[model samples]
Target chain A: MPTQANSSEPPELGLSGRKIIYDEDGKPCRSCNTLLDFKFVTGKLTGAEGTKPLSAQAPAECLEKLGTGTVTSAAIGESSSKAYPKEDPPDVNQLGRASWTLLHSVAAKYPNSPSDTQKQEMKQFMTIFSHVYPCGWCAKDFEKFIKHNSPKVDSKEDLGRWICTAHNEVNEKLGKEKFDCDLWKKRWVDGWD
Target chain B: MPTQANSSEPPELGLSGRKIIYDEDGKPCRSCNTLLDFKFVTGKLTGAEGTKPLSAQAPAECLEKLGTGTVTSAAIGESSSKAYPKEDPPDVNQLGRASWTLLHSVAAKYPNSPSDTQKQEMKQFMTIFSHVYPCGWCAKDFEKFIKHNSPKVDSKEDLGRWICTAHNEVNEKLGKEKFDCDLWKKRWVDGWD
Candidate 1:
């Protein structure tokens, strides 16, 4: 069936969830010149509340603030013998090897090595995010952004404002500078300075 | 610190995280109003990812179609014991009364209830989502959405378009049409018609 125009495109992997992003000024869409007032979208899925298969959309202004993107899945394919632990401190060897594998996965795919700071930040995000989100280290950095920047605000209005300011700062930096992803990757993989 | 701004009056709950609200066409912000665009936001939590926090504002246009929202830990001071499963058949109810207690907990706190069709769809999503997402029905739902919608889109641009279209639709219908906390509480305590 044809879903709504705003629905998701339908996932091949069957996943669904949401995240919040903030800019340097702590706003939702600060990266762009403007901010969003309000928005919404919906669709079907293969899972429940926080997890499912779905299609959805929101205001373009709102999407800009969130900085949404896709990172490689950290789950080892079934062909691999490693078992990913659901709890904290997954088997260290398994995780390390998985990280190594993920490095290749990233390199072969996006191949963008984040800055030293970005790499370190990604590592921090991975360690904490594994406990809360799937994909292990592959998506650690993005998850970290969610935890630190997201406000404890209960009001949508306040939350929106916070998102807007932070979003602005972050976007401003990206617009102003150029990042070297390949160099960062070498440091992360071979421990190169 | 003063993380973000508050464009409007403070909400009782002070909302934060990614949130979605739909319009009459069931489209997100930009589709409804072309002059505007979607925004993107990113951040790093205290214990995760890149040093400090980083966020950005994206183009109002769709970069990756995905769904996201603010995390609401609205326990509302109710005892943890009062929490209930958001599902209908209801897992975690092995102990009968204990299960009932969980249902009651959910009834009081769950932002919305599953409609007749959604209740059925959730069951299907849970099974598939379990493979990708961790424990809990919420995670299952989120996983299903990601899998069903975000596929074949290799770039941020495509992903944004996917999320905006799919996630928005499902979220719109998850909770009942009109959310009434008092009414739901009555239904939870005493079976509703």
Candidate 2:
């Protein structure tokens, strides 16, 4: 059983009152929620209102709410029970999904017969995206992925297929289902038929 | 009254069967939904289920579901009254929001005192982002914005502030509230207290 923290008082407004999981350098860990869950089976979770323990399963509706990124900022605090009505910052998974959507959408719109300049720019974009992506470990993984499989910018279709394959690689690593590359056009460019 | 297309048979599975607003070159117009709505004011809409006309209002629950990117792809097709159970591709607004979230989150995590290489990479990232953002008009506007106010990537804080201001500019154009720049750390780096 996880240690239960007393939750009687209304929590303070900011991170000052929260029990943040920190790294060796005292910086708050980006994956604090996962880390905290792994270390202890705490019944009460922080940063999300009505978050259940890791062992306890939440109903589909609750999970849907959480997945939709509707949880308030106050609920995300360290052990706070109050649900302030402010949008919470997205976590790594949310960020990743969003980033992938943007990237794939952009690729879908790439000019079919792109100029040399366009191709060069797309390559640069991927390189920079790998560098600036917020998740440190994920960025490193992308960088390595790029090194092994350079971007194919010959045409719009090429770029779209390349991105889809790259996305599938990430999905495979995460144990998620791989999207059919053949449906790339249908999914992004042409819409499903 | 808007011209009503006969809703006799179930539409084809692809975008071709849908009445997508297209440019002269047969490319799907970026503002198809808006264009379609302007041309027709019928309660029944296509391409994005539950998407209201610009003048109409959606209830909070519908808006929340839209914000959460929950509408299925089937909801986006022509005359599809049945709501499919699977996750759908994100619409333009949802895609934009998600993209912004990733960009802002990455900017928030930038190194405060970035090295020259980091600075160069960040600058490059902005340039490429402006060029390749999926929305055509949005990309053009971003390009202009970049030309007017070059990206400031000297430090992490500088980048965060710059991005926040840029985001606010977009918000201003969209008639949305501007986020407080002072709360950058609280919103992105640290959990709110």
Candidate 3:
């Protein structure tokens, strides 16, 4: 069947009496759940809220940015070896990667010598972006990041480097490898000649 | 040698007087050039401005958004066999694809129902976004799009569909497939059941 152009149906909880994820109002938090859990919902293998899948035999922190405490452990013998479904909508990680691509591209093409008005526009864009990003915790962290770094819109190179450092901070939190910020131009504007 | 934490060096034109890409002010237009050209500058195989490579043995419209008219042909007998270098900084197409991913995900995670304040914030974000998108021509087109469609921030579903339609317009212009807007929820918010 052809998918309709529009539907008002709420997303399926996919919970058969299992509270996998939600906020205070019992709404599934899209920004908090990994596609791994969303897949579990589809397969009817959902655990209760604060439930996080363990990739190894160690305890894991639940997706807790929008929830409560992230315990340093997982249930023993849970055999945490599920592959995430890619066809599903983005999870937190996917969203962040895509947003970084766009955000960095913005800085990449920024004028080398921007007018005052252009500089102000970039600053304003960052302020409003923090509000509209779907991840509440991520946005709050960005608010603090902006307070400290601000948007260095004086030039394209400056803005790109600033944004890259900001991304490195997020990488630190996620345990991802840090990109070489010195290569910001190579990554976003000029090729690594 | 370690990549610098910072450098004020201008991007290498990679030109041996070939005038491959530049605006009127003799500056490289980051948003105007493709990674392919950037690579060429690295290899120094540049043509004049408005030059676009042929992917097949056929005439092609030069990338003319930030330039003048696109001629309907490649130079005769030029082999169109070059593959875009993956590690180069993003070109216009790569930037567009990434931006679409982030923009769509925002709608996906949006609250199913939102407050007026949230709605205003979303609308403002879009407004500012069109201005700050690095591609000037693309941004102008988006400005026209927003003026015509406005933003449907009243509901997540509404915004998703609206943004999907907007993306379809871009897809159409790029001669790419128009994604089924009906499957938007499946693509952006939920995995297929």
For model 3, what is the alpha-carbon lDDT of residue B107? 92
In model 3, the runs with Cα more than 4 Å from the true position are A1-28, A40-86, B1-34, B37-86
Instruction: State model 1's lDDT.
Output: 0.27
Report the lDDT tens digits of candidate 3 across residue range B1-193: 1111123543443222112355566655556555444444433334543244333322222332222222112232211343223354555655776688788878976888899988998888898789888777789889999999999999999999999999999878765556777778866776454
Report fnat, model 1. Answer: 0.00
Looking at model 3, give its docking quality level: acceptable
Worst 10 residues of 3 chain B by lDDT: B65-74
Residue B174 in candidate 3 has what lDDT?
62
Report model 3's TM-score to 2 decimal places. Answer: 0.65
Q: Summing lDDT over every window of 10 consecutive residues in candidate 2 chain A, give the lowest-scoring window.
A: A10-19
User: Model 2, A27-130: lDDT tens per residue?
Assistant: 44453233232122223345433333323244533433443344423442332343233545666556777888888888877898999988999999998888
Cα deviation of B39 in candidate 3 (Å)?
3.7
Which of 1 and 2 is ahead in TM-score? 2
Model 3 residue B78 distance off true place after TM-score fit, in angstroms = 35
**C-alpha lDDT of candidate 2 relative to the true structure:** 0.61
Predicted complex 2: CAPRI docking category: medium
Which candidate should be chosen as best, given lDDT against the real structure? Answer: 3
Ranking by TM-score: 2, 3, 1
* Best model per DockQ: 2
Relative to the unseen true structure, what is the C-alpha lDDT of residue B193 in candidate 2, on a scale of 0 to 100? 43
